[model samples]
Every structure is written in structure tokens, then in C-alpha cells.
Target: MELTITSQKKTIQANVLQLHLYQQSKVIEAMDKRNNYYYVVFYQDQFINVVKPTHMKRHSHVQRAITNGISLPGDHPLVNKLIGQQTLSMTRFNQLFKKLQQHYPPLETALILSFFDSFTTAGSIPKLIKKTYYDFRRNGKMRKALQALYLLKEVDAQNTFANDLIGKMEFQKYNEAYQTLDIIMEKDPVYFEDICFRHLQDGIYHENLLMFYDQKNRHIDAIMVLLYLLKQQFNETHWQQLQATIQTWNNEAQIIVLSDLYRDQPHPIIEKELTGRLIGSSHHNEVVSFLLEQNYLPTQTEMDKIIDHLNHTDRSQLIQYFHQSKEKFATLRQSITKNQLEKAITPFIKAFLSTYSFEEINQWFRAFHESNELFLIEQTIHTMEKLQDDPDHQDKLGELYASLDQVEQAIDCYKWEMELHPQNTKAIQAVAHLYKEMGNETEAGTYQDLLIQTQKYG
Candidate 1:
């Protein structure tokens, strides 16, 4: 019976760490590598050192293995280095060589797995390896000799055989054999890409193929696969895999991918995460725009985060979001710092004047005045002056001016109201009262007389 890779996982899980100690027992490529070689360790299919991958290139061998497929010959120096160590002449290990020759014309993946199964320690079965090498040479089966030679090496051999199998195995055959997450976890990420490329050849896609790219941390390829999955009929398992993959990334990494996901579809998970990431991220303008475009309103606190970082260019988006949102802005006012409110003042005023009742804007300005935000009140009055210029409604501007103690401006607005409607007693009285308050007795008596005349005419 052939061993299924998933069913016998404990044996697979504890294989040699694949990092080798090199040049004075310092671990290097295919081992617990440190500074000496360019070893890329992965977790959840993503590289452990993503930020400075180029900085890792001290040796070309590992980079080459990762970029270009590995296919080492029997006499390669790396191969020789691998088998140089000694081990017992074990019968079981030698049988691996027989299985390879018997199945040599088309070496099977099951036979390939046996090599890893027999593996015990470094050089654990080199005696069998040497016998196999000599037998293959004697039998003139040099390629099988190389396959025997590969048994001494671990990851590189798995990589080499997997590359060869790509050319020979049908895609589904390879996918059936190796696409399981447990099986994928143990193999080189490059092999997974090869199989994905094969699957793409037919223009047929499965969201589950994300396992090859997403789980393996094949960054560029992962994006293409993720986009495809986004377009397919929604699948919970597919989305869960995508979410789990993103959960591993740093905020910076998450933002770039999430932006792409958001563009392709408006899933709530995508919108929520993209909204969160874009705010404090370098893409703050995006957060503002994203919030505006989204149907679900962000809480006042969430909007304030963007307001705190507001730049001149994003103000328009803020204005767009604020349209008709008085209650939201009112809540934002209590917690917004002075500087943040200042930065967002233009948008806030535009929103208020556009949606606020004529009386409501004056009340809002009074709240600003009480807070000692005189500048904000002035800005609102200025915007209202340009946008809501109704001669009949000078009372609104007069009230704001009076609240600010701009008595002369308040008197001028009330006088304008008196001129626009001579029969209006309230504006004439307001003018007389403000003049008296300003100690201008002449203007006070003049407006008081004008008020009496207007009332007499009415």
C-alpha cells in the first residue's frame, strides 16, 4: 500500500530542519541558516524576512534554488558534500535504490516519499546510498544514479524531483498528490507555483488553489490568485483562507493587498479592514475617500482619526461625507482637538451651511463661541455671508455678530434689515438697542425714532 502523505504526517512533520551547517558548522542553506547563506524561511506561505529579502543574498545557491528550479547532477559538488558523511549500510535504505530502478523509467512520487521516510539522521543511511550509487553506475542507469545521489540531500532533492514531476505529471494528478495544506507546508513554495501555472493553463480556477500561492507566501503570484478568487462566486472557505493569510501580514503589507481586494469587490471584511488600515497608513486620503464611498457610516471617532491627519487635498472628501450629517459632526465636536477642528473647519462649515437651518447655523456658532473657538465662528459667518446672503435674513448674521461683540457689524446687519423691510419693528429696535449698548446715544435715539416711525406707519 502506498503511504498517503496526509495520513502519515507526524513522520513528515519532523523531517530534517532542512538547514545545513556549513563552513565551520555554521548552519546555512537548507538548514537552520543564519547570515552565511540566503535562506528564506516561511510561515503560512509568506517569507519570514519580507522587508529585506534582497539583503539576504549572501549566497546565490539558495536564491537560485528558489527562483530557478533545482536539478543537480550526480557528481555536483553540493551532492558530493551531502554524501561525504558516513552512515550504516542499512538493507532498508538500499532497497530504496531498487525501488527507484524498478520504477526508474517513470519514477513515482510514492517511491520519492520513501527516501524521506527512511531518513533518520544526517548521513543515516549513506552506506546504502553508496551501494545504490555503485549499482546504478554498474547498470548504466546514470540518471537513476543521480536520483540515488539525491537521497543524500533533503530539500534540494524534494525540490529537484518536484520540478521534474511538473514536466511529467498532469496538473490534477500533481494537485491530488500534493495540494493538501499539510503536503504543501513541507514542500518548496516554487513547486506550488509550478502546479498553479499548470492549472491556469486550462483557464479553469478553483479558489482552493489559493493554498498554493497564499499559504506558500508566493507574494506576486498570491496576488493574481487572490484577485481570481475575488471574482469567483463567493466561497466562505476561500475567503477564510484569504483572511487567514492577510492576518499574518504587518499593517503595511495588509494595506497594499487589501486595497486591491477592495477595488475588485466590496465585501464588508475588505471595506472594514481597508477602512482601518488606510486611516493612519500612508494612504490617509484613501481612508477619507473610502469612508465617503462606503454606505455604512464610520463612527464619529473613526472619522476624527482621518480629520486629525487631514490635509488640504482630502478636505473635499471630508466635506462630501459631512453633507447633511449634522449630528455626526456635533458628536465629533466634543472630542476634536482645537487644531484638528481648525484643519477641518472649512469642511465643517460647508456641511453646516449646506444642510443646517438658517437658525441652526447661528446656534452652532454660539457653541463654537463658548468654546473660545472664535476663529471657527468667524469662518462660519464668512461662509454663511457668501452662501446665504438673504437681505430678509440679516437677523441670523446680526445675531452671530452680536454674540461675537462686533456691535458695529451687528448694527449694520440690523440696519440693512430695517432698510429691506421698513414695516419690520424688530430690526429697528435691535439697531436702537445695539447703538445704546455701544454708548452711541445719537445713533440710539435716531434708530429709536426710526423704530417708532416704522411702527406708526404699520
Candidate 2:
């Protein structure tokens, strides 16, 4: 029968030492795999040498292997070097060869040669292999052949030696993995879920996460269950229960649990909750709409609190509210800033400029400019566009443009305003004043001509 290990159904209780050792070994192995090729031996507190396969380059054979997926027959120099070394153990030598086979293709000759330099007179084979295994595992390579011996009881399993080996391991590796997994989960929830699903069979996957959600320490089971449901594409009803469960878990100061799960299974629930809260306030619709566009799902109560603060509070209250809930308010505040400026012109035009007359809308624009509201700014600009035909409105537009520091556009608007009221001395003088400021002698002369004509006509 095939062995099936499901974390949910089975208890993954590992002994403290064994769990620590197994984890430490994984760390050392990972390091060896990525960095140095050989396991290092230290003698008298000094680095002795590395133990790795040694083979002289045999190009003709290598080229043949590349082309055919099999090496061509050639004399392996390592085998010849090892034949003279009668001190080499055939048992250990053979074991090394099999281990190399698991990663690289056949290289029996090189394995024997590697042993001539690599092997040291360690007290016990199992203890030595365990030490070497941890070293290699930490370094990031599979010393599976040596590892298999330990598992198969081919090597010694004495606690005194094994425990000594385990204690020597660098805790940094385990700590680093925990930190790394934490970061990966926090930054990307979907990726976390993928990792969990990919390694579902490995009890160690649960073991690693259990650091954050250990029942005896701080139970985050409900949060994990919620995240698992999200990972499994749990429907609305399940998500609702998960929400309740998470709230209960939250009461225990266990945010790490939620954070871990979020890193693995970021879903659309956040935006959904925010939208529910945003509908309560008409002004907040812009904020809600922005969140919706970004596909953000704020938690329900979080959104409700935001809406309540924004709609019913004084300026001091608003500042205090956001200051206290920085995480939730950060995105909302940013969205407000972006939308405020943009919403003003577009929505204002739709609200007033399309149907309202210039004179009638001027008071609204004044209120908008005084308020410095983003929606009102857009509306004032739109209202100005509607009054393009009126001399007073045109002068107001010119003043508005000048106040905004669009000097060139403001000058143009002043000229246009003069054209609308050629008889008005102030309008004609304003054009001449702008032309003079701009150092446009020719344009200034033209404005002089307009002023003369306006004075004569009036």
C-alpha cells in the first residue's frame, strides 16, 4: 500500500531534538548545495581540506556523453589513482559513488579517488557521516547516499554522537529559512498557497508554519483553517465562517497567524469588505470606487470604521483616527489624495457645468475654491469652461489660470477676455499689462492698438 500523509488528519508530533536536528540538517544541506562543492573537514581548529569528487577533464568522453546522454568509454584516472591506495574502504567508497549517482550521472571511478583525500579517520562511521551529512545539507547539496545509510541504520545511531553533531549545526540556517518563509508569505499570499499545496505531502511544511501557530504557544488553527479554505477556493459561506473564526483568533493577539496565512492565500475578500462599508457614505463613494478599481478588499469592520471616521468626525478626529489605524488608513488616504484632484473636474462638470449657467454656477465655484476640495477644484475648472463667452467669466478664468501659475495660458485668457469686452478699459489695459510683462513688444504694440480702438469705440 502507498503511504499517504495528510497534515490535517495526522498528528505530526516529532521529538524536540529530532525535529531540531532534522531541521538543522535541512539547513546545512541547503547551504552546501548552493555554495561550496565539497564537505570541509577541520583539524585542531584549522581548516584541513574539502572532500569532493576529483576527476581530470576527459573532453572526448564528456562530448560523447553530451551528444548521446551516455559517456563514451575512456580510462578514468581517479580509478587508477585509487587502485594503488589499499587504505581506502571499498564499503565507504561504494556508498559515496551511489550518493554521487543520485545527483550526477555515473562516476564510480571519481568517487574512489575523492575518498583518498576526502575521508578522515573519524571515530565512528555513523557519527562521522551524520556530521558530514549535516555539513553538506547546510551547504545545499544532497548527500543522499550518506543520508540513506543513517536512515537504513547502516551507520551508527548513538545519541551521544548524534546529539553532539546536532548541537554543532548553525541555528542561522533554520532561523533564516523561517524568516525567508515569513517574508515570502507576507509579500505574496497566492505563492504561499502554491508552496503549501506543492509540498502538501511533506509534514515539514506544516512543521515550519507551526512555529507561528503552535497550539501550546499561540493557537492560530482557526486562522490557518481560514487560509486553507481560501487556498482551496472555499465559497462565500465558508469564507464568512472563516471571517468569524479569524475575528476570534484576532482577540488573542495572534496577528502572526493571520499574516502567515495571508502570505500564502491572498484572495479578493479584502475589496469586498471595503465596498460594503463605503456604500454607507455618499462622499466616501469616490474612495470606495478607487479601492474597487485596484481590486483591494479591506476587512469589513475596518472599512466601517474608516467610513464612520470620515463622515461623522471633526478634523482632529480624522487625524487621530488615521494615526491610530495607519495600516488600514494608509491605502485609503492615498486613494483619497489621488481621487480628490481627479474627481473635481470630471464629476463637477457632470454635476453642474452641463446644465447650470455661468452666473448661477459661479457661487458654487467660489465655495469649491475656498474649500480646496479635490472634487470642487475639478468642478470650478469645468464651470469656467462653461462661461467662456462672458467677459467677466473670461476675466475670472484668466485670474484662475494666473493663480495656478500657468502664466502663458493666463496671458492668453486675458487677451480673450479683452476681445469679449473691447469697450471695457480695464479688460483692454489688462491685456497690455500682460503683454508688457511677457516682454512681447510686438504683442504689446498690438494690445496698444486694441486699447486705442476700444477707447475710441467706447
Candidate 3:
């Protein structure tokens, strides 16, 4: 005789106990009563232990099933106890009840049950949740816990779990929050609008991300995350709202986001609409910013629009904005693979130098120059050389040449320029004066000869 007990494997069974239980098959055996427990010989030759149907100790099996952390075992009293009790912390309750299994644990159910009990009585779950959040955060469990906690909404539980999630922002915990979101997006697959809303409320959303960039001011990560969000699907309202937000970002921070829409979106009509709405600005500074920050080489039509916009804005304001925007542009420009600056950076440098004095231009380039930002170094030198005729420009021009290891060229540049403008008495006297002061007797004698020669020729 054999026992069919596939699901009953864990009960105190060795091969010998199975043989003894099986040997009694189909016999009218004596019922042994030990304390109030009963045993019977079954047709399959197994000794079955039974408790009275209404007995309290039957709860041990019921509790076993419940504590196993699957669905509640049917009609069990411990179900109420498990669901009702707020006495145990989520972690501890799971440990005590054997819910925290070795592999593929019932973590979700445990967290939900604990959250149910925690939020069951409280009017304000904020502080508890906030504390729970930090605990999960500190333990590196936020990602696992968030997916579990998010399911509580499905249970129609009385808790503000989602709201609490949106409000917490420890700097150390932000990466965890980001990882949690990545998991939710992959696992749950919510609607486009819903994700957008969640992202917006999280304050770590796509368009509004640069506050961190400004705080950390590490523009590369900032722009990378910004681009990553734009690549995601956005519904109509969020798409437009984000467009407007990017438009204003372009205005305020000189960061451009909409051109990425063209890269990812296929519909020409959508592209045209984005072109008209967000990147349509004709202002040279604005257009140059869009081109430089986003690596967008404006099409001829776009270039025309920029030229037109420049007509409307004050030239001085454009110059001022151009100066202000270079720091941000340099931050992005340094990491780029291709030198897109030939058209974009060179024109801005030319425009900036053609109008602003060298002192003002140098002041604008000062931060990036000092930091030795690689992308704009050549452009800065070229712009400085172009602006060299300005009265206060000599020292900076000398500085630029000295930086290039062309110290002799720098000295000669000043001397030749003064020679070309001898009528500006300062230039003439400056050369004779500086050569004599420097004890360059031969150079001083040559300048004196030139002065005498000029008088005789006159």
C-alpha cells in the first residue's frame, strides 16, 4: 500500500513513518486519544491526525496557512488577527509569522498587510509613512518597498502612500527614488499621462529637472536625464505643457529641449507644430542657444526665423544674454564629440566682439577661461584678437598670446599696432617710452630713427 501525500511532505515524515502509516491501510484500527487529539487508519494505510472541527488548536493549521503568506486560508480566525493587528512592525511581523521565506518571499503581501494595519487607525499617516520611507531608504529597500506599497491603491486601502512618496527628497535617497520609478515604469506600465503627472509631482520630472543641475551645476547629468525623459511617451497635454516649460527654460536658463522632439517624434505635423511653438523664436541669442545647447544645427528656415527675431530684440540685450549664456553653453559644449561650434560658436563670438568692448567680452568669458573649459578656448582667443583694437584690450590680448606660448608675437602685436596708430600720440610715445624703459637700446634707437626718418620724409 502507498500514501499519496505530495503536498503533505513537510510533516514529520521519514521513509519509516510512511511505511508504518501505510501498513495500517483499510484496517478497523483502535482510535488512540492522546490529550484530545484523535488518530484514524484510512483506506490508503495512513494514520491521519485530526482535531475537532470547532477546536481552537485547529488554528495552528489555519495560522500556518495564513502565515504562509498566500491568500487567507478559508474561514480562519487568524485571518482577522493577521489583518486587524497593528501590533507588529512590518519587518518583525513578517519574521514572526514565517512570511519572510527564503526564496521568492511574500514581501509584497507582508508590506501591504503592515501598511493596512498602520494606516487603519491613523488620521495622519504622514509621519509614520515618512519614517517608514526613511527606514526603507536607509536600508536600500525603497525600490522593493515602493512597488509593494503602490499596490495598496488596488486594495482600496485608507492610506496616502502615493502622496507621501511624492514629497520625500533626501539627496542621498533621490537615486533610490529614481530606481524605484524605473521599476514601476517597467513593471506596472501606467498610462502616459499618469507617468507624466507622477514625474511632474515628484519634482524630478523631465522638463523641470534642471533645478538640480543648478544646485549641483553638473550640466552633463542634468541634460542626460532631461533627454531621457523627452524620449519617453507623453500625452497631448503633457507634451504641450512640457513644451511650454522647455520654452521658458530656453528663456531663463538658455537650455533647449524641444529639438529632441524632432529626433524622437516622426510625425512631420508634430515637428512643424513644435517648430512653430517652441523653437520658432527668431532672436539670435535664443536661436543660437537652441542650436548650441541641444546640438541642433538650425535648418535654413530656422536660421531665417532667428535672423528675423533678432530684428525685434534690442542688440544690447542680445549681447548681454549671449554673454550670460556662454557659461552654460561651455558646460555642455565641452562634452560633445563633434565640434559643432564652427557655425554656432564662431558667429556668437564674432557678434559679441563686434559690439562689446574687450573688457566686457573678457568678463563674459572669464569663468570658462579660468576653468580652462576646452570647447571654447580657441573661440575665446579668436574673439579677443578680433577685439584687440579697443583701448583696454592690449593686456588681455597679451595674456591670450602668452597662454598660446607666443610671447614674442604678443609683444610685437602691441608694438606694431601702436606703430600703425602713431598719430594717437599715446601709441608713438608708448613704443619709444617702453623700449627705453626696458633698456632695449637697439630697439629704442630704431624707433628714434623711424621718428626722424618720418619727419624728414614729411
Candidate 4:
């Protein structure tokens, strides 16, 4: 049978999820603004059914019946018999569960009562949970101290000479614990890492934290830790060791770990490490990406290397680098082939057009034309036109099309130039010449006469 609900009031509201019994269902303890309760099952933005309780009935009993009816997954059919069977009164619903609790649900009233009671005391739950939290934290610290003590014994066993120093460490007055741990860290960084887990989060910063993760292994982290550490501490020896350790992991993990290192601390060494790994992994053109992400300004030598790489074959990488780092890339120009320019996105193309001189721009235009990359040639010309760097762009575009024997496109370019600059002798002559060449003598003669009139009058 279908379910139905009735209310003379236009609006009704209910609280939800405040009790765990109905936390996962739409069942709610609905009420109106006057706190007049509705003993109802609500679903799909509407109340489906309700049974009005007795005049003096406890609101909690009906609310509990509505919420607990569906909370039981295994006893769903039985609970439905008591609570959801059309208009079961509050007195009969409570009697059904109470009288049958022995054979079925087999749960005490205290269990149900406690489940509901906990929500009634929601404000105190966090306090109850945290009452022993400090003791737990103190216990954790004691465990860490014991772990360090055990490791220190291992360190002492490894060297007979430090037994006296280690033994004196028990006395805080002359222990010099920091100095002792620093020596242990310098001797074995992994032990130092375990001794100082989470590093500074554990409230200690070892002089050898970099060495700890370095021993753990990385290319960029090793380098960044070098950057973070005293530059005086890094000689060729440390770098070579770091490099050797990083080279040991596969390229993919190196990419991931170094990518993390780059995100965490983006120094030039990390950049080189990540870029080299990315390139080695056939990640064709991402060398410029970290610079974009980190807004890095590569030094002159780094810029030269990128430009040199472009000349060799990584064109997309080079243009993006120059585009994103325009200030550092100023005063430097790199030759680009038509193939490289064809692969460029519009933003990089725009940037490239702004910085390159006319000669370099024309070279790629001709290259695109040679390779039949006419669209790119047009884009380059259009980008140049927007920048308005060249006063004779219309003539240049006309010349490019005419070179390729695309006389219709060429004539269109010249005619547009004539329309914009009516006295432009080159445009008028080129249009007239092209029209005459196409055997359209009427149009050609009209343009030829206009050209003669302008030249003669001036």
C-alpha cells in the first residue's frame, strides 16, 4: 500500500542526525515552530506517515520509536511491525519491543538508553575522549626516550671509546646530550632520524636532518637540504654522494620524490634534478614547467643551456622557458625552426613574437611556408600585427602568400592594405598587379588608375 501524510500547517520542520539511531537515515524528530512534535517518518523532502501520540505522552518515547524503528538492519521487519505499521500508537510500540527483548534483539534497555543518552551529553564527549590524552602523549614521549636510549646503547657498543661519554650522559649536569646526539647523528644519520622523528615537529632540529633524509635517499631533497644547510658543509664530496644515492632509485620514484622536493623547497639544484629526471623519463617538454610553477628566474648560464637545448631539438621547452621568464631571457635570442614554431601554443607564440626581431620572425615565417605550415605562418603574422611591431605587415603578409603562389590569398591581403591605407603605393600596385595577373582586367585597371592618381597628385 502507498504511504500518505496530512498536515493543516503549510510548513513543518524536523531535527536530524542529532541522534545516532537516525544518523544514517532520513528518519527525524520533526516539529513545527511551536515545538508541537510530529511522530512521523520523513523521506524525500516530505513526511510520509505519522501517529499522533496520547495527550500526555512523553515526546522522548515517540522520538525514540521513530528513530530506532529503522536503525536495526537485521531486525528491520520486526521493528517495522512495531513502529511503521500504519498508525501504531506510542504505547503499543514501546510494549512490543519491551516484551520481546528477551528472545529477539537480546539487548538490555540500558544499551538503547545509553546510545541515546550519549547524544544528550554531546558537549562532554570531547572532554571524556581527551581526559587521558595528555597521559597518552606523555607515554609516547617516554617510548621515544626509551627508543633513543636503546639506540644510544647500540652507538656506545659500536665504539668502546665513547662508553665513558655515554655513561656520563645519565647525569644531566655534565651529559651534554645535544653534543652527544649531534655526534651520533654525524656518525649515523638514520639512527638520528628515528631519534628525531618528524624532525622539528618533534621539537628538535638536528644539525644533520639533511643527512638523515639524504641517507633515506633523494636527488632534490638532498640538494634542497644542501641549500637549507650551511653551504660551507657541502663540498664536492657530499654532492657526489648525494648524486650517487639519487641515481640508485628508478627514474619514476626519482621523479615523484624530487617532484615533492621541488614543491617543498624549489632551489635551482632541485630544478635541475627534477628536470633531468623528467627528461630522462621521456617527459619531452616539462623542463620549463617547474619554472612556471615556481616562478623561477633561471640564471644566464641556465638560460643559455635551455636555448642551446632548443637548437638541438627540445623546442617547446625552450620557448615556454623564455616566455615565462622574459626579463631574464631579454637581450638573448635563439633561432627557431618551422617545426618548433608549429608545435607552439598561442600564448608562447605571442610571447615569442614580442621578443624576437623582424629578421628572426621572418625566418620562421618562411620556414612555416616552406613546410606548408600556412596556418602557423598566418598566426605569427597575426600576432605580429597585434603587437604592431611592423608598419608593413600587410605588405609582408602579401609577399609571403605571393611567394607560395596563393594569389587569391595574396590579393586579399594587398586589397585589405589598400582599403586601410588608400595611398599605400606598394599595396595598390601589388593588388593591381595581382588582379591583372589573374586576368581580371576591369578590377586591375581600376586599381591601376587609383595608384597612378595618388602617385601623380602627391
lDDT of each: 0.48, 0.39, 0.41, 0.45
CA lDDT for candidate 4: 0.45
For all the candidates, what are their Cα RMSDs to the real structure?
Answer: 19.9, 21.1, 27.3, 21.5
lDDT of 1 by residue, 17-79 (tens): 232221111111321123322222222221222011333332232343333322222222222
Give per-residue lDDT, candidate 2, residue 117.
29
How far in Å is the alpha carbon of 356 misplaced in model 1?
Answer: 18
**lDDT tens digits, residue span 1-458, model 2:** 01111122432211111000111010000013224222222111122222333432332212222232211111212112212222211234456446555654322222222223224333333444455556556666543332322231322335454444333344334323324556645543223333443453454564444443343232223233334545555357646655665454322222333323334444556444434434443434344334333435444445544444344333332233322232333344444443432432233323333345555545443443434544445455665667666666777777765554445666777777666665767766766777778789888788788788878877
**TM-score quality measure for candidate 4:** 0.29
By TM-score, the candidates rank as 1, 4, 2, 3
Which digits, one per residue and each the tens of the lDDT, describe model 3 over residues 1-458?
Answer: 11111222322111111111111011111112232211112212122222122232322222222232112111222112222322211123335325423422443323323322322333323333445445566788765445434433322244576545544563335334434544434443222113433354354454433443334343333333343344554446455444544453433232233444455653454455555654544444555444434444345555455545544544455565564457555664454422443333444544465466556655665566665644465566656658567655664564555444344545565666655555443344445545776678888788777766655664
Flag regions of model 2 displaced more than 4 Å.
1-198, 201-269, 272-292, 295-393, 399-412, 415-458
- In terms of lDDT, the best-performing candidate is 1
Model 2 Cα shift for residue 68 (angstroms)? 31
Give candidate 4's total backbone clashes. 0
Judge candidate 3 at residue 340 and give its lDDT.
47
Answer with 1 or 2, whichever has the higher TM-score. Answer: 1
Q: Which ten residues in a row have the lowest lDDT in candidate 1?
A: 1-10
Flag the better candidate by lDDT, 2 or 4.
4
